[model samples]
Target: MHTKASVQSVADTARGIVLATVEIAARPEHVFRALTEPDQVVRWWGSDEAYRMTNWEMDIGVGGHWRSEGRNADGTSFRASGKLRRVDRPTALSMSWMSDWDGGQASVVHYALEGTTRTTRLTLCHEELVDRPDACRAYAEGWRLVLGWLQQYLAPQSTEAFFLLRLNPPRPNFSEDMSSEEVALMKLHFGYWATLLQAGTAIAYGPVADPGGTWGVAIVRAAEMDAAWVLTDQDPVIRSGRGFRYEIFAMPQLMRGE
Candidate 1:
């Protein structure tokens, strides 16, 4: 995971041009789909509390049209439309972008993808902002944030996980064998998961009954693996000094309504 590339490099070249580059651990075809596919665009193009991209519509061909709709943190709406000038699948794309906020000025945006079987190098060039130096600086920062979101969206780790819990002794009738203090601790554990479940962060959690022993499992949603660890660390079973531990497994594609 440490070897995967993500952070972007930005540069101000000519008077009107801002160039940025980022490496993604995905095939060119996969990255290209995220670039052109409407559903994928809405997922990776922005963040929930920042610039949220709620809608995307595009026609995939040279001379076709594209549009995006989103909102800022302040509840203000924004929109951008473009006509595709070039479309090279798995390689490059270019378009003319006209946004409502930019005095309706059309800017040329180009993306060049260089990739091997496992990774891709994506370069973006936004031109025609030479006269709008303020816009040029803003774009440099904006593109940096955009590309960072893309990289995180494409990361291989699952945002949801299963936490398997067990007692150190592994007894079949442990529930019946538990002391009064242990029962209180178990209640705390149940309450903790209940809170998360009501908050929609915890999906489901319960005990697994085996003939020889009983173990517990919890399914949860977390934005990152480290975040998942934070939840598990806070589990009452873990913090109560009861010799309880949880083994976590990532569920990259979780089935809903199961």
Candidate 2:
């Protein structure tokens, strides 16, 4: 499951700035594109349902210019313009943001993305708001909601089926006493499943400490049984020439939150 986005606000009353952070379930490139790409920006930039973005244009490079015009629910038009100071793909973007409502006042907005392969932590720092501290606070809240929408937009689609995966080995007394090669493959197996867990594909996965014999169990979400099987088939353990295999069972319903 995608976790809730985290929003942090650090107010420097001495300098007048606000910093916010949020984690997204998508990769850095995807997150960066969503922030820079005009089509994607319109989908989540504003919070109000009646707020309509009439125009969004971005040059998206160092020294480039960008502008967006939108109308509020009450039909009040607003325009924002910015000049890109830095545009490092998939990592950071720095720009100067100005709004017509602010009487041509401007602030520096910096977005930094950092995380692993499947997850991205976005930190947005708005600084140089020497005159508009209230705007700084309002933008902090606005970004919190905008990033929440981005997370939902990037979440995986609902699965058609959930499957229980049972991993079987050739031997019954398998443990740390296995061959060095086998142990290495097992580590890879764990990492593989960990990735699946991070991607929100596997609901739960771990080794079962059954007294009879230990095995692996995983609950996977997929569109079809074959898709679920494909994940197991590609497991490092199964591909290591070890006699390991999997059986899958369909689960029609899973109850949660009683």
**Ten residues in a row with the worst lDDT in model 1?**
161-170
Tens digits of per-residue lDDT, candidate 1, 138-182, equal 788888898888776655454344433333323557766998988
Best by lDDT: 2
What root-mean-square deviation over C-alphas does model 1 reach? 15.5
Alpha-carbon lDDT of model 1: 0.76
Mark the 10 consecutive residues where model 2 has the least summed lDDT: 151-160
Model 2 Cα lDDT, one tens digit per residue, 1-258: 324545565665457687778777667866887788776677656656646666788997799999999988788999989999999998999999998877778788999999776678888888887666777677666666666666655443344668789998768888746888788888999999999999999989999988888899999888654456568868988887778967666677866674
> CA RMSD for every model?
15.5, 14.4
lDDT of 2 at 117: 62
